[model samples]
Target: MSDPSAAGPTIDPMDTSAGNRFAPYSPENHSAPLWIVSILGLIYTIGVLSIRLFIKRRVFGWDDSLIVAGTLTGLVQAIVFFKALKSGLGQVPEHVPNLSTTASLAFTAQILLLIALYLAKCSGILLLRRLFVRDQQNTGRLCDVVLGFTVVCGIATVVMSSAGCPSTGSFTTHCSSTNTRWSVVTALDIATEVILLLLPAYLVWQLQMKTSYKLRVIAAFCFRILVIIFSIFHLIARIKYADTQPSPFNIVTTLVWHQTLLAWGLISATIPNLKAFLQSLSASWGGADWGYTVKAYGNGTFEMKSMGTQSRSHAMASTTGTENATDMDQKYETQIQTRQVGERSSLGSGGSQDMIIRKETVWTVVRS
Candidate 1:
């Protein structure tokens, strides 16, 4: 890597001297940055749609809120990075018209990226808590442990990022510390994602659902593995440029990988909540409702009717009662008894039994 400072004092853009010439911006230099911005925008749009579906179900929780917050921060970082590119961040130092402005934008963009990454990780942790922790009392313990660990990691990342480039006076002066900081942050990020992925695998395995259903659910949540893959790529890019002085290609590569990491992080966090939307779309296309309907009768009996194309019905007498004889049928008085039949199966050898009993009561009173 060439010493950036040894290249000489900053050159003014307006200087017409032959030695002070700067390369003109072209499509080659701008394409990567524009592509990164467009990708970020698309990911943000999808994340927003997923979150909207989640909210429409009236199941919005802390995890969803954290994801939204992280996304906003990521948007800010993207804008700042775009500005840095416009200000000559990915251009050769000699071609960079205003080095000071570019350095400032780059520093601000990194700080925002660190904060956004932390928030996204925390969002994933909160999501795991909501999915796996059923007991309210035990929720605090597991959530606190994960939250504290994430907070510590976040603080360490911010501190290191800030310490890496304490002053924006010169970009190359901080290369060594910046390299170490990014490597640490990347490792911690991969660790947190692994923890998030493992936390739910055990719970999913313990579910009483069919094996295929369990595998499907596990696969949906396992999308975080993509985020981990992106993080690895980002780490590799950082390492590749560890010894090189900041240049147009190096800066663009780092920015691209960084955006990719954040994009996948947001996507993974939002994917699970999209199941309801996907189911709705499938139902719309298939023109079938896949659920059971329960109807109660005046005789203290109820029937479970399958609503879809594969229709089946089950009727069980919940209670028996005799009405008191009266002058008029409408004037008769009766006391309806309610009883819950536990684990009743349909009247067939291979009928599937209801593993859980649903208790409901219906009463009619008449006076004349």
Candidate 2:
């Protein structure tokens, strides 16, 4: 559907509100940044779907939930962003578009969509926590806290988005600049973004695995942190513009860019997990059973076992023609026992040292 905001009257450039919050009502004000947000949103949506369908396993998992949420919000945001872009970029009409009705409905719809996006983001985080984190703490307790907080934030955002705007279906005024919703939403956003970043670090640290595996887990956490940083910057830009009247540029940056970052982070965070999901499918294709091996010689070797095997016979030189069968058997037994004892002692020492080093590395990374 076309944006309800597009049907408004074209406001001529003149002495007006400093920020011009209602300038978006005119079709002449949308600009490049808004369009860029729309484009990024579209890209994110397409990439998410393509990865989920073709690249990653479509199984029910944290990665799958995240991809779905990202794609859904990304697509919705693209639609709204496009509408915002078109409303601004279109040719100015001889008479102003009657934006009163449009703005009223658009404002209401925007509020609902914003709430939905918030929920989606929270759900994605919860899914990740479930899949990646294995702690001694009760999972249900963590989930309850997250869900309760998310619900509060979602309600707050919805209320604030509509608080200063005209009542539903009324076109008299567009959203107001003094509405506390803008600042409230921004604050909630920053808080949630920080929570998302910090929890993953804790989750990675608590994972029970080898040191190398733990590092991989931490890398995943770092990826999430980077996205949170991007989102924080996005929120900061919006918070700065919250009270300003919406210029074409400011509106695009405030509303559209913020949505894009939220969606983009959701998509980007799932990419690694999606990749892992895809790689797991390779196991079903009869690939070799591959793993690392430590030998008695203090060297680590990577190896794979396939389906074939062979046998070999060893010939021992006879020392005398009078050797009895019992004597020969005793000699073979002694040789086998000696070899086994030497191999076991070396392997035991090496294994113990490796375990110690692994524990030390794990503690260092996790504590940091």
Candidate 3:
């Protein structure tokens, strides 16, 4: 259903006799990776968002809202990808339902994918701002610059891609200038990933946290490196495997790699911010009962010192493996304790009374 004047000549999808021919071997299905990665990533993203909203314990913000939108867009993008696969992607063109249809669907998916990725990155940046750049003026300003730059690059890609190709024409074949545009977009994408990676690594060291604790936090944000890798691979696939015309074999691998990146991108964005909720999962980050000693100390309350006093007194204390909760707060003390989805108590006690101490609290959530 392409505008033949703009897209040029086309053939029926099922008319393999008129379709482009590929390798002689039997075609393999690449949709498995696409399906696995897209579905699972969406499930994880939605599951965490549900906890943030319905459970109502976790603080919600702009980042969470962005993730919700991104997830919806991603779902639509995935469906388009599947439709492309059904049309002819990753198979012998002759065997597919329609090469022209596949091309159109893929173009649509490409647009949606860009939107999904843009939203996810924005969400991550917002979360990063809240975590490290909230109070620091310079760092916060730099974070704003990054966010603005991302917005520009996203718009640039959308404009270039929208003008580059249509449903029926061959892209990356005769469109050398369009390829150059994509090269620019790809470079910006990689730079964005690198910046994201460095943000946490650079800023975590600036915190009053101990070196070891800072490294752990940096490690939690390491998925950005993989995102960079996927970005490069996605560019390569787009530039290398394509034909002068639409072909299923060439597009399938690109789809697979793109899905891989998106899945990991979700992980990269969510894991760092979800640390609080993650620690409570009992399955994440060295689960409970790792031979750590605890005395069960918590007042489970946030209260003020007095009606006339302008100061607040905290009642919860954080303990390491064996550190006592009664001690005053230390500058570099790492909080090592179990956390759960609904704020489950780390220590179970029947006869002992609840002890109250003040512990620093950070309200954070996940996004993808």
Candidate 4:
């Protein structure tokens, strides 16, 4: 039933070995390396999920898109990881079934998934623009342009990848005809990666954060830029060895490095958003319960140090104390009563006052 022409080379015809191939695709030769990488990926994914679930809120905003992107990418890596295990270590019969189709499809999906990861990188930065940019119109227009570019790159990658195959048959021998197109896609991919990495650095440099905060933000973005360097290495490897016989070891090594960077990129991009989400959540619950109070009397107006607004019109008036020593005792008592009442009202009504307020003179921090 077997076609003589369709069978690939024997692993060792003279020895008549049961499972080993004499000459095989590179990845099929070794299982240990792939398994190791797979385990590491699993461990990393677990850590990522934990942080995503349990982390407390911080000062920055979290982008859900980045979260989805990270989750999807981890899943994709896991799929490829299992495939690598099979291809590298699984037994091969004298006439093993050709997996060119399955393998090719898996690799294709991996590439596409990576591109999606990169696009998510770009999208995350665009979201940051919305948060940090004071100019509404500029942010909106920049988002439109960046989004359109992302779409074009994605379409190009999919089309070129599918078209690279010579035929639909999985068993076909020359399925690598589209290598040229892949090269083109890789170049475009690298360009977009560079642009995405640079944009964040530019934005961070221009932000009006404190010197210390600015440095911290810049360092975060810099780590992402280093991920792009890994991509550059991948691109170089791809170009250097694309036409050579499939070296599973070399390819897997390259893929592992690339995936590692991608994992870090997710973490890096999520940091700011994570900070924001926690801060917002903290402010929403029990944060407004805290307050600042100032007790004073006379012609002089009492200012609330904690209140950000220019006037205390929104603040309830405490017992009036003015120009009289005897009134001080009564006035202080009234102040305490009024303060307690306002705090109770605020809690009962569910209002948000800035969680941390700095006072400028006259205003006393009655409660913080």
Clash number by candidate, in order: 1, 12, 9, 17
In TM-score terms, which candidate is top?
1
- Candidate 1 Cα errors over 4 Å, as ranges: 1-57, 136-140, 283-368
Looking at model 1, residue 346 earns an lDDT score of 29
Tens-place lDDT digits, model 1, residues 32-121: 454555456656745664555454334456776787788788788878877777677766677677777877877887788778778877
Model 1 clash pairs are 90-248
lDDT of 4 by residue, 1-368 (tens): 98987887655533434555433333234334445655675577556545544442221223444556656766676676566445442223223344554355446545645664665566565555544443347655665676678668867866776665533232233346545765776676666666666665565555444555555545545555666676667666655546544434335555656566556655555554334344445543223211212211121224333443322322323433233443222211112212120111221223322122111123333322
* TM-score for each model: 0.67, 0.57, 0.66, 0.58
Please, what are the lDDT tens digits per residue for candidate 2 over residues 269-353?
Answer: 5544443344445533122111111223233332222212211012122334553443333322111111111111222343322
Model 3 misplacement above 4 A:
1-25, 28-57, 171-174, 243-245, 283-368
Question: What C-alpha root-mean-square deviation, in Å, does candidate 2 show against the real structure?
Answer: 14.0
Ranking 1 against 4 by lDDT, winner? 1
Candidate 3 per-residue lDDT over residues 174-197, each given as its tens digit = 444755766887887788878878
Model 1, residue 209: distance off in Å is: 2.4
